[model samples]
Target: MWVFVAAVFALLYVPLFILAAFSLNDSIIVALPFRGFSFEWYSAALDDVDVREAVGNSLLVALAVVPLSVTVGTLAAFGLTRFRFRLKSAVAGLVGAPLVVSWLVMGVGALLLFSALSIPLSLKTIGAVHIMASFPLVTAIVSARLIRFDRSIEEAALDLGALPRTVLARIVLPQLIPSLVASALLVFAWSFNNFTLSFFTAGFETTFPIWVYSNVEHARALPIVNAVSTFVLGVQILLTFLVWYLLRLRPGGRSAAAPLLPGLATTERTDG
Candidate 1:
C-alpha cells in the first residue's frame, strides 16, 4: 500500500520535478540533455518587466478575492450550519455547485453572464470570477470546522444573557480562526494560480499563469517559463504546508477536526 501511494505521488510530482530541473538547465533548449546548471533563466524571468507586471496583476486579483471569498464563505458556512430556513439544503447545495461544475464551463458561464450585464472583461471581472471559483472550497473547509463546533457553548452564552452578536464575536469566531486562516491561504493560492477563469475574464490584463500560457509557445522562452512555473509551484507547496501546519497537525497541537469548544470536551467526557 505504501509503495502504491509513493508511486502515485511520484506520478503526480515527477512532472513538476522535471519542470523545476529544466528551469535551471543552462541550455536554452528544454530537451533531455541538461548542458549545465545555471540561473540565467531565473534572472531573465525576473528581469522581464512584463513578467513582473503579470505577477503584480495576479497578486492584486488574489488579494481582492481572498478577503471577499473568505468573508462570504465563512458567513455562508455559519448560515448553513446554525440556522434553519426554507430551502436551506438547496441553498447549501447552490453554494457548493461550483465544485461539481467544470472550471471551463464555469468560466464560460461567467463570461457570458458578465457580457450580458455589459461588464467588460478586466482585472475586476477576473477577481469576481475567482471569488466564485474559490467560494465553494472555502465554504467547504469552514463548514467542516463549524460542524465540529460545540453549539452548547453558544447556548450557554445565550443563557448567560449574551447577545447573538456577542456570542458569535466572543465564542464562535475565535474557535473558527484556524479554519478561516487556512481557508484564506488556500483561496488566495488558488486565485493566484487560477488560469481558466482568468483566461476568459482577463481582457487587457495578463495574470502570471496567463502570461506563462501565452509565452509558452515560444521555444526560446521555455526556460524562463519553466522558471516562472517552478516559482508558482513553490508558492503552492508553501501555502499547502502552512494550511497543514495551521490546522494543527504539528506535534502537541490539537487537531482542527476535533471539537473546538472546551465545554464540548467536558460534555463528551461526562457522556462517555
Candidate 2:
C-alpha cells in the first residue's frame, strides 16, 4: 500500500517538478539539455502587463465565486441533510452532476444559457459560471460533514423555545464552520484553475488559464506562461498550508478538526 501510494505521488510530482524547473530557466526556449539557471522568467512574468491582468481577472472571479458558491451550497446541504424531502437522492445526483459531466460540455451549455438570458459574455459572467460549476463541491463537502452529526441538539434547541431560524443560526451554522472554510478554499481553487468554463463564459477579456492557452500557441510567450504557472503553484501551496495550519489549531489535532459545526452538540451527538 505504501509503495503504491509512493508511486502515485511520484507520478504527480514529476511533471510539477519539471514545470517548476523550466520556470527558472534563463532561456526563452523551453526545450533544452540544460539552460543556465536564472530567475529572469519570473521577473519577465511580473513585467508582462497581460499576465498581470489575467492574474487579476482570475483573482476577481474567484473572489466572487467562492462566497456565493459556499453560501448556496451550505444552505442546500443543510436542507438535504436535516429534512426528509421528496426526490432527495435525485436532487443530490443533480447537484453533483457537474463532476461527471465534461467541462467542455458544461462550458458550451453555459454559453447557450447566457445567450438565452441576453447576458453578455464577460469576466462577471465567467465568475457566475464558476459559481455554478463550484457549488456542487461545496454541497458535497458540507453534506459529508452533516452526515455524522446528530440531530437531537437541534431538537432540544427547539424544545427550549428557539425558533427554527435561531436554531439554524446559533446551533447548526457554528458547527459547520470547518466545512464552510474548506469549501470556500476548494471553490476558490477550482474557480482559479478552471479553463474550459472560463473559456466559453469569458468574452473579449481573458483569465489566467485562457491567457495560458493563448500563450501556448506563441513561441515568445511560452516561458512567460511557465512563470505564471509557477506563481499560481506558489499561491496554491500557500493556501493549502494555511488550511493545514488552521486545522492543526483545532482540538484533537488535524483529523478531529473536520467539519464539526460550531455550537452543535458534538460530544453528545445531537441533531443538527
**Cα deviation in Å at residue 228, candidate 1?**
0.9
lDDT of 1 by residue, 58-110 (tens): 99999999999999888888789888999998998899787777778888898
Q: Which residue segments of model 1 deviate by more than 4 Å?
A: 1-3, 249-272
Model 2 stretches astray by more than 4 angstroms:
1-7, 257-272
lDDT of 1: 0.82
Question: Which candidate leads the pack in TM-score?
Answer: 1
Per-residue error (Å), model 2, residue 96:
2.1
Decoy 2 TM-score against native: 0.86
lDDT on C-alpha atoms for all candidate structures = 0.82, 0.80
Global fold similarity of model 1 (TM-score): 0.89
